[model samples]
Target: MPHRRCSLWLVSALIVPLAAGCDDSAGHDPADDLPADAAAADRGSDVSPADAAAADSGRDGWIDGDGPDASGDPPAADAGTSSSDEDGGVDAGPTLDCGARTECAGRCVDLATDGAHCGACEAACDASEVCLEGACTAGPVEAWTVDFDFGGGESALVEDFAVDAEGNLYVVGTGRAAPYRTLPGSRAGGFVERWDTDGTLGFRQVMPHLEATGASPLGVAAGEAGRYYVIGSTVGAYPFDATHASAPEDRGYVAAYDAHHAIEWLITTDLVASRQLERHGDRLYAVMRGQEANAFPIELEGVRFTTDDGIGFDWFTIALTTAGAVRWGHGSDTDDRANGLAVLADHVVRAGYHTIATGGGLSSHRYQLDALDHDGTTLDGYDDFGVPGGSAVAEGGGVVYVAANGPDGWVLQRYIDRTLDWERALGEAVHVSDVVVDARGRAYLGGTLSGAHSFDGEHLGEEHDGWVAAFDAEGGLRWVDIVDNPAGSLWVVMKEVEVSLASGLVYYRYRVTSRDGERVVALRQPE
Candidate 1:
């Protein structure tokens, strides 16, 4: 049935604790968490009947008590789990009206206007509350709300999501409507959806229009201030002419949106958009996947933005200088997908994932974190952050935090730009997807959690909640908020997490269905 909750507890309490005890006394170093059953069998110990049963029952029978703790191979590095894994509406429901039968943050407050419970179940409220512009009230809104149902079956995978200084939630996902499930009036869109920071359903459009009628908006990036940008391949339409999009095919596409969710302009080039999008300074970069015609590595490009009247059109391509036109092409890594990139202290930090040997017994793909010049040319410094694959990085003070899925499970690790500082394992269960750090140095990690970690960052806080988990700069976990079950799978988790400094709230663009309806709960740092 559903991964037995009893089994989950056993792994945590009985198993993990006993394993830790064995490590201390035996003085034997693990090649990183060799299953208890396997380790014990190697020791040739006497096993009880029930113990053998447990081992057999857990982890595909790879359990010490049951079997050799099944699915081994250094914990299947969670890769592109296409397989795995709400919101603000248009003012259609009643005003401040909620059912009292629902269970909330320890009380039966009205789901509507109850300062404590805004939308639905168990979403508790803090003490002194205030109402902002969302579907709920304020008081440091923990509002993470999203509605994901682009018409069923066809799922929208948000590669990256972020919010502007104005509190607008920008989500970048790949799906279709024409053949799949498009919006009501749209032909069938392969576009991005932009929601107001206050959870309003105002802005939605085809991310990047195509001229050849072939491509769609591929990659997207957002800045800390008021700018939003996306990259793709398409000889798309210009702001002046909707009729212009029916021409030819464009490669490296770049589109700019202002704080009001209005498109400024659209520019098309020649970059096969493979990964997502990233931004450092004023420079916007999009990394294309696949090899080039010359049999070289992948391609990379960046474009600069300038405003033309209210609509931002006309900008220079950063990959080359427009003055006299010089071919100062960008660089790429051995890996196909663009792992991540960041700008710190005038030094541009770029990272990618590569598969290599580690400790002989275990060899897998980890991350490559590097520092380059502002022009995206000069390589300053970099290293393998011990994570099996390249990941998103954030630099503050002297430490840089990376969110990655490595040899272990999920990790929100910190490095000193040069040295590997620390990596506190977030989920003792699965892998982590994205990591972000705030101006206050508070670190937030988004991934699938088997259970919640203690707010004090000690042990597994609760057996509930699998998806959203947050940790501090010191690697201490703050909270783990459960989203919902997918179909019949309870372990189904949330992926991308976008935090807003303006409201001190976190927004996860992934979709989760509750009882009566779908919701995106904005979980706050508990007070």
Candidate 2:
């Protein structure tokens, strides 16, 4: 964990010299000695001097004052002002007494209430927030929340979600029984729903279980002009198209839906499960996995990949036009699991973990990041001693961000031009669920934390909590918000996170575990 020096201007006035244990080498400004009212006002409440001092006691490198200055003697009350110079000559002029105001950028401003300079100079609050008690307070407001009912013996497990350019949200998941308002007789099936920006349910399409084995939609990606794609697996015949029926064996599928929720085209293969889908330009990329023997002559359109002996499971990546025309297909021979897919302007990146035979029938798991050219050729590859989790690519394909379970803990890495730029260890026992990068190259990660963990300089206690964090382009920790578990809930898990480019709001889906099973909640955090 990296230690960040506490900003000097934010410290209280009653502290002794060494008690400000942080690096004090920076020149001290007169604004450091703010009046007691400013301290109380910053907290939005009245407090005694001792109480104000105690408020920062738990902060890193902050301690109670007990001794004098370096000269072994206490300084005068008005230490910021001196009548004479250090050489004992006449002073330049008398100092100004702004009374209750701090001098910031050559102006007397109330630090406690100034939104542009809250707590310290230039510490501005967000547009939707106000400065209170010297701190930026308010939202990241929850714009809205919507809940779904599984009805009867059915339960919902959100597989993936996406937000289109028009701010409409699309969610895809699996339900054990029929969803609310839907016709009954379905045992287990997959569902897709669209919600308007204002939380109105635009449309809900439920694909019921037609066979003994169920149907599950694992991934979704929004395309241009009000179109979207979903990739998943079905154990029986094709559910969307009757003329395209298949065998009882598991089959992977990719279905395209138009603006009016009408199926434009549907494609299927013997590839078992397609776990992730990504859209770039007019093309769609999907990653699928299946046992070699189960999918011997795996075929998608005219593209094909064959295996011998059908020993272990293999993963494949297929590129196709939005009209369901397969462009190319690439497959891995080893035992690997695909976790995520990110499409850039010129290429696509696949993130997952690969198992290697370490002799004596033992194996080792290594994180794998492979960059494939737009034409489905391997352009570059990276592998390390970890388990790859999720990945996101910045705009223009110039940078990439990946999250993995490293040897020591959870780690987030930044890659530029297919090269490792930097890696940051999140903390011990942090389970990262998803990662997404905005247009400005900022990365947002959501997950759950257990035990004690330090994110940048912020410390979380032993209790479990869900967290959403933002980092800059250079991998610097910007800020983290913890979603505490509610009462009567055992724990919380963040399943997915998506950043709406049109609205700049971050939407995250979380599940709360209680005595009655798990409940799903979706919240959009305002910027």
Candidate 3:
């Protein structure tokens, strides 16, 4: 069962009172009184009784009650209706007969339609939201959320997520081994989970653990024809294939799966790690980083790529066919790191940081963006943003947006045809993890905030809060939303943000430092 958080409702003048028909006959179902569209939006039949019980436990800020007397137990019917028991203690009044409604604070509330108690006892919908089929939704937009955990004492880290053409979501992460015996002496392995458009989990495949010490899937991309790809690094022999054993060093692997979750093809490389993967049309592009000295004269797709001196780390970008055959591969012999990758109509863009050795043995980092032809030829110059790298890149409508950390704060720059279009400085103390653009030329950035910072007019400076913000093509701020962490959690960081082309909904994947493993939230783009 998937865990869900009930939408919050403002308690001031915006609170909508419960319907008077809630106190009707005992057998009356409140759903019948709802509007035709609202009644059709109800998804209560999809939630099992165990799921409802779990939601009642108040897991992810969805409390079961509202005030001091908001316990799961029913309150006294009247203030003076209590009676004394045989032991001289005051006995509480009889529980209210709410019929089909739930008793919250001594009042009967229809959980299915009551905005004040939408899904749980005293749970409230947002001010702009209405209770529909036990879930809070904003008009025609359906809110989808799910929380995933591996098991007890096991930690899971969500790396990336992608939405398929059918609106199904796929999340890739790594899970630490639990105390119980599964494959003895295994440390950790990777996993991929899929959720359908209706917020139901389709499948979860935990990778087979052989004798590998660590296996982490760092990136994922959804392709055509119900195909998806996962790229990661592993130690010891590759866990996905036993026939092709690798040395004890870190090796990168990319695996393609069909609609039935069966592996269609797998490719392993001598590279250290795979940073990012993007699929565009009939081709797939990926960027990887590794030390050339570790594996000299690396062979990828029968092509030999050798570094200049094998002294510094190098980054490689490769284009591959849908059948896992490499078409072209390009490598850079420098101390550079791969942060983001995006494919355009005629070029593949790579964004990251490059380290330059200054005088007196000091090194300085500068943001680097490179454009390459589809045949692995480097295009002429790209404008230097003069900021530190570690940036993320996204493309939409032939324009590219890069988000990087600048001396003043975080900078978002727009580029067209390798030329600077415009730039904006977001506040300081903010680190951007990923940036994505929707089909409508709207760019969205997701990251964590440390100190006080302002996004347009909204202010969010919580210690470690996750946030997502949107921007128009003309560099105007749309809106920003702060994804507050649950109480008592160590921190929360948004790892990736993806826009569903089919549904036009934005999905955010974040990790909470609490016992809750990872959470995926979907929201419709506001008009």
Candidate 4:
């Protein structure tokens, strides 16, 4: 959701086998189902993107582009198809021709905007109303879309959106429309909007200091209660490489909002514009592009919000540029730097890829994940799984699910505690960036396929479009679904998935990384 300078990590306290960090011998468990790659292949292709879209669309009730947790018994298909379904073998729902019928939840309806399913399916809202999270109540999809009026080819562009537990939807992006209104040619009228689930528009306020018309909110995570966090960069804040200015003034922003759609707190950091935001309880976590300051973070500080306001929150700093371990600070990266963190109930898992060696300059190594305290205390005995793509840590069924995307997907392992007892790889290396787990102990991953797509026009489509493979509880290979019929990046790249326990909706979002085209899909899977 935002970008920043880099550098952070602590490989180990003491050195043993020292593969990377953590105690590999303690909790490593062999993949339960099929190997990552083979698991994808072995599963037959009985399901399609339609099946996944319908039955297992969301675990909770409503689904957005943020989470992915769905379960259903689907008819058998190509073994490769099983690789894509997270629940493995079973009939999830009835397969429908996506192009013909607009799929929402699990039922197929007419696409000609109805009173039930507005955009697709039996999903029709009132006359002028659009569908938000199924139900066909009232109002538009998001606050941002209703507030801004573009007046160009399209009214506006909705880059990112997130919904809270109160059934209120929050969206931030560029443009100006009614309800989602922006000042006339105000140039920098960048804004964030929040809408109630009943289709009532809440707040539509504008943010100051955005560079141009390009800066838009990318990733978003809802916090405890109705709090919201957004991340994205300004078009030309400081302008690093000449053409704009001398010093890197182009900075990114991570802001917090209260339930009533008000800025509770915010800060500007010089992170490269990226779309990735994750909330660890009350605090928000992101992989921003900031300047590589000192070796570690001075402290884990944020804002103080009593009621839609910041009450003198401390201004702390950390220089986590590379890949090293830290107690209360950031670290340095090897070649380039990158770090990913996710929150579990009791622990916050921080992981890094292509980690370099520290000190007297030892040989360099790649890939490792570490669990740390919410206050920045590195947990003990980590190191059982080897990941390539970014990693995601989640808790369901009383077990913690740590899914990391790697080159193809050879390096992957699950854990119950610090000791990793099982570890295994699919060996194909498809590069699954993140993973999500359900209450029934199922894993769903999303990312791009390396050689899977080719760039044409502004869209990225593949011969088959990036595939989503499903793995069994023990890491057995399940089914894999080839998304999208046209093969464009439209439905291929699953940037994120939101799984809500109460709502039972699994929202999966995908779009062209090139920032072209508009595609929004919502489906409900039958329990």
Candidate 5:
């Protein structure tokens, strides 16, 4: 049978205090829970004469006078009240008090374990809900989540994501497709899928081109009128000769997909690697990393290439019209690569890190951010942000916010007019993986943390959990919430975080592992 409801009620009441149990064990032994005859059978002795005489009068062998008769039945009435020794017969046992205000879906149920009223009332779970590790989660999670191992049993990784104006999600990743388009280990192709606002799968497609080695979709951006673009580097020919560059074996590609999921256009470039892409107005700006300057031709308009003598790489930005026409480009010979990009009304910002020659003939990296004018010229640049491993950029309330991860911790910087306004760190030693800035100038940060950490005076417990915190424009923390895993399990790691501008809902994706197995979960923060 299922775990006894009595045990569940006992544990739930002890933890939450929503219910209370009757304490009838002050003078009772653990053996009192067993039946009288069963207890006697374990004694290996017949009932004594005195005990039999007492049972004949009004009691059984039980110490209390409220046990069953020798025949396992309640005793007859002696006066206005009856003397009985049965579990539920003639007041033989005391009543249990579960609490006075337990309610769920208009029915009395345990909130700690009830699927229909987990954590709060009316928060019904559509699928199976299990209270594992002190938190309630529904199986086969539906919303704000995409599990790569859901059905195909293939190992996959989510690379890039884009959210549309209507709160829909577009995700691209690399993995072997199933049933429809199957590729072997080294020949895996890129896959893209869209999720509607209600968490339903809209469509799924695998890139038709196959690479001899592999390909990964590194960036995605949503544009006007529901259109979107997918960009990545390919290891083999892309099949479309008209769009591929002279040497198609190793190149980067940018493909546009219409609102109806139809392929509109495809283009290839000599750039060997592409990291990120951002759409502004009627144009797209892509950060491309190249190894040799000779690989790019000067005749290609809006296309600039720079190289560090083939010893290091050059990072640059290429602007292209919606119709795949190059507009403007800028290149730099620094030993760095751009990781993030954001466009504003008057300036375009790129955030990344560069390797610098240090003392002792060594080299170290430093974070860099540059503001470029419309003509692809650097108007201003800042390089004192520290060494960053990954970064993201956003604009809100005319202020630009850049969140990055470094050796120290997570650093968030706010800038106005290419000048620093303020900067803050999450804590002394924690990893902040991703951040999102809403239109109201509210910043949300997500990462992994251990031990007790305080954010803006809000205390998080001394446990390993996924943490998401919100802060106002003035760098004041608003709230911090923890998404804990099962006890004794490894700490939770955040993979992605995004907020829907249209719904004001914050979505985060995290992964956790326990003795039971591994799980990738997507959860929404309650308002």
Candidate 6:
């Protein structure tokens, strides 16, 4: 793979540089690319100051001076081990012991680049795999070859999708008639469908209450026990309503269904706008944005919303037990809108934007990322000013990445020590829809870019296409690709993108206009 290095020119967009050696080439082992003179330098002689400085700077793109022992001085030598010091004396950092042999997959193998035990214990590789940058891979995994079109007339649109642990796919959106019988009050509106791994439809259930309420499915989240939840806003009155609907009231709703698309429970809340749903542990987390709560003590089973003190748009987060008991609820005190939610480690991270006044009542919105403990106590938080869209967070390898549309373009921020480590941006201004970080520290971002755009140093022709980009751990661009119509007449707009950590594949849904009607298509890409 060719290294896609970032330009150092600092423009309006805060473009950052990616290290040259960070790219992973097909079948290329990183250990084999080490400088030939490294062994001689390790002999404790002929070491130059510049060479030490280069190592300290992390020119190789791995460990940097951010480590505790990287203080620009020769580290204290461990017992029975020595290396050349700054003054040509014997001193060095701690030595690495691979024991009698490198351990991998519960067995001892080689250390100088054995594929099974490349550099550390249990770092086993597949058959015929090579150790590149200390990572093992057989090769590029096959991406999905899926094509689906529903409601072929003028009504099809996909909003979101999710993959369960068993690799089953769940897609939710608004469309035509349901392919199967649905729950009572089901109408010709939003629908939820399940598919096998090979793109075969298992069942499609028309999500009800949308026809009368004029609501559509916004997001879908699959639970641990083979259950799934769909959240959206509806105008119709439900079984739990306190008052029958005289007119359309935008009330938020969350419904749980079994693997066979049978409704288990349905919940409706006074909070009018629902954004998304996420499941963590045994609790279901739902986020919504609603206007000032005029009605105090609006109650749902085990949950309540009160805004007796203020009148403005509010974002609320509610946590519920598997059986639908609200465990806790949190809400913002400002005019904030909830964008997304994720459960990372022992904390729940909520991302969105809140507005701040500039002067004379004019205001601009800034993105905020808040981390809350399991019990809903606020912990560390970050505020990104001036970005139009709120930042979205994804966790991988204990690192959290936040992506947003900055003043100039799409920006990705990395936080280390709960503080900003690096901020990177793409050159062109594009509407970023979603972002996902992988276990290997790579970030995959999807959105639509109009006209011509550049990724790293590579340029593409002018076209309106849904674009997906990959960035290495060091914030270097790996590759950029586009999804467009072969005829080049239709505009492909990405609606949502989801990544499967287990399969290391990206699944995205987009929309394009055809002669028959509007078509919503889903495609997959290899990680």
> What are the lDDT figures for the candidates, one per model?
0.41, 0.54, 0.58, 0.38, 0.50, 0.49
lDDT of 1 by residue, 1-527 (tens): 01112101000121232222221110011111221211111111011111011111122221112222221111211111000001122233344222433334333343543334445554444433332321333233333334343123333334445666655666544332222121223222234444454343323333211222333444566654445776544333222123223224344455665544334555444434544455655555444433243233223233332211222121112332211122233443434332455555565565566556579599666566645555655554545464554366766554677777665655666776555678676445544556666666667665554565443343343333445555666776555544444453444344456665554456653333322112234433332
Model 3, 71-131: lDDT tens digits are: 1211111111111111222233567666666676566666665566677867886655556
Could you say which candidate leads in lDDT? 3
Per-prediction count of colliding residue pairs?
A: 40, 4, 3, 150, 2, 1
Q: What local lDDT score does residue 247 receive in model 4, on the 0 to 100 scale?
A: 22
**Tens digit of per-residue lDDT, candidate 4, span 1-527:** 10101101000011111112211110001112211211111011101122222333232211111222222212111111000112222334575444544555554444443335544444434442333333443221221112122112332334456656643556555432222122232233234544333233344433322223233454566666666777655444322111222123434555565554434554454444344455544445554433445122222234211111121121111212111111233332411122334555666555555445577877456655545555645567566556444555544544555665465553446667666645555334244545666566555555555544422122233432444444446764333333443422232455544333333333444444333323323322211
Question: If both were scored by TM-score, which would come out higher, candidate 3 or candidate 5?
Answer: 3
lDDT (10s digit) by residue, model 6, range 257-364: 665444567666656545468776577887765555544444557556543243435666677766777766666643324345766667777776767779997987
TM-score of each: 0.58, 0.68, 0.69, 0.51, 0.64, 0.64
Clash pairs detected, candidate 2: 42-133, 42-134, 43-133, 154-177
CA shift of 246, model 2, Å: 4.1
**Candidate 2 structure, TM-score to reference:** 0.68
Query: Would you list the rank order by TM-score, best first?
Result: 3, 2, 5, 6, 1, 4
> Which 10 consecutive positions of candidate 3 have the poorest summed lDDT?
10-19
lDDT by residue (1-527, candidate 5, tens digit) is: 00101111000111111101111000101112221211211111111111111223222111112332222211211111101112222232344323532443334445443444555666554433333222465321222333444323333445667777766677665542321212222233355655555444444444322324234466788877868887776554443222332234445677787665445776665565454777777778777665555454322344443322433246666677777777676665532243467777777877766667788999876666766776676775444455646566766656788887677766888877877788888765556766667777777777777666656453543456676766778887655556665566676666666666563345565555442112222333322
Better of 1 and 4 by TM-score: 1
Error of 6 at 61 (Å): 49
Which order, best to worst by lDDT? 3, 2, 5, 6, 1, 4
Off by over 4 Å in 2: 1-137, 149-154, 176-185, 211-214, 239-247, 294-297, 306-312, 333-338, 381-397, 454-462, 486-490, 515-527
RMSD of each: 19.8, 21.5, 17.7, 18.8, 23.6, 21.0
